[model samples]
Target: MDEMPALDKMIIYLDQLAISQIFKIKTGTYPSEAPHHAFWTEVTNLLQQGVLLQQVLCPASDIHRDESMVFTRGDELTLTHEMLGGDTSFRSSSEIEGDQVWAYLRGFVSGKEPILDLSVDSILDGHRNEWLSRLHISAAMDWTGIAKDVRDRREMSADNMVPLYERWRADPKTSFKSVLKTELESFGSSRVTAYLHFAEMARRGLGSIPNQFVE
Candidate 1:
């Protein structure tokens, strides 16, 4: 027997949980009303942990006010990378590039579900958030390297730098002072000491060490 690819497993799990229950719960219908079975709770938990991705089903619903639609039906949905404790990475259907996964999804929902017509090709699209997520991850890794360099230079005593390391994490606005303060506190170094040390290193034409030093 061929083993299922990891991506396929993820899609199957998401399809089962997202499609099956989201419709009923969001629609406020009794068919999906059991608190224990509510899918959003699980979704919320995943989102909090940055383990689940949320794609908006588009062509927004236009249901008759009188009808009780179980889920928000749409022709398209977006795929995004949910970051733990940070913003989400949004990707369009076009971004998803797995033919086997698409085929599996089509087969999985072809005649079984009313709202999902997997036959309709789903396009993977790109969003600003996707770029933002990448940028955030990049900056975070870079800052971690810088912090570790500082720690190694000063021989500071700290178990893990994550608390202060998070200062470089993505935010709407970037503030050098905020980042400096966080690094100072985390490394147990004063602002002058840290700045002078880094400045001297820069003056000496010493470029940032490779990230592998910390990782």
Candidate 2:
């Protein structure tokens, strides 16, 4: 059998969770699907640091009654099928750290070690200020030079990547996915890594996504 694409791997990781399955059955909308921006907005809120998986399963924020189109009843066979192959460990109110949520992608993208600060900074160069405001970090650290430092790494030289980051900065309207696609291809990373990065970063209210790249 062919290996699953990285993006699908990430999607399946989410889909295989019992809570995510309930979200699908009750909401009748995939996390990637639209018409439920508010739903996902709340979901992303829960995905932030410190929030537990059980809390996300029943967020403190109320779901707008009108927006919830519960086409699949909770006890339905279809819903059961969805959860049959899911990871049900969280059904017991087990705490899920934000890091644990995207662990699958992190493992795939950079192996056991987390994505380095240098690589993360490179991806968020133009948008660092916006990202830093939301993500708490040491104020004393010099973040201004991180992008350049990562770009200067010897491993990236063969990919001719320096120009790409410049181009992304030059074009304010560039779709993040487009830039990410190029980077992943050049760096020999999977497309799933790009989408996983996008799900975490681009969706962080930094900027408008180009229509062509809409989920």
- C-alpha RMSD between model 1 and the true structure: 22.3
Candidate 1 wrongly placed segments (more than 4 Å): 1-13, 30-40, 44-124, 127-215
Give the TM-score comparing model 1 with the true structure, all chains together: 0.20
TM-score of each: 0.20, 0.17
lDDT of 1 by residue, 98-119 (tens): 3444555577688543343343
User: Scored by CA lDDT, what does every candidate get?
Assistant: 0.38, 0.39
Candidate 2, residues 1-215, lDDT tens digits: the string is 99633321011123324344445534555645567656655644444321222221112101111112132332242333322222211211222323343565587686675543323222211221121122322112223334345434434564666688689889989999988887768654554566578787866754566667766
Error of 1 at 115 (Å): 37
Candidate 2, position 73, lDDT: 38
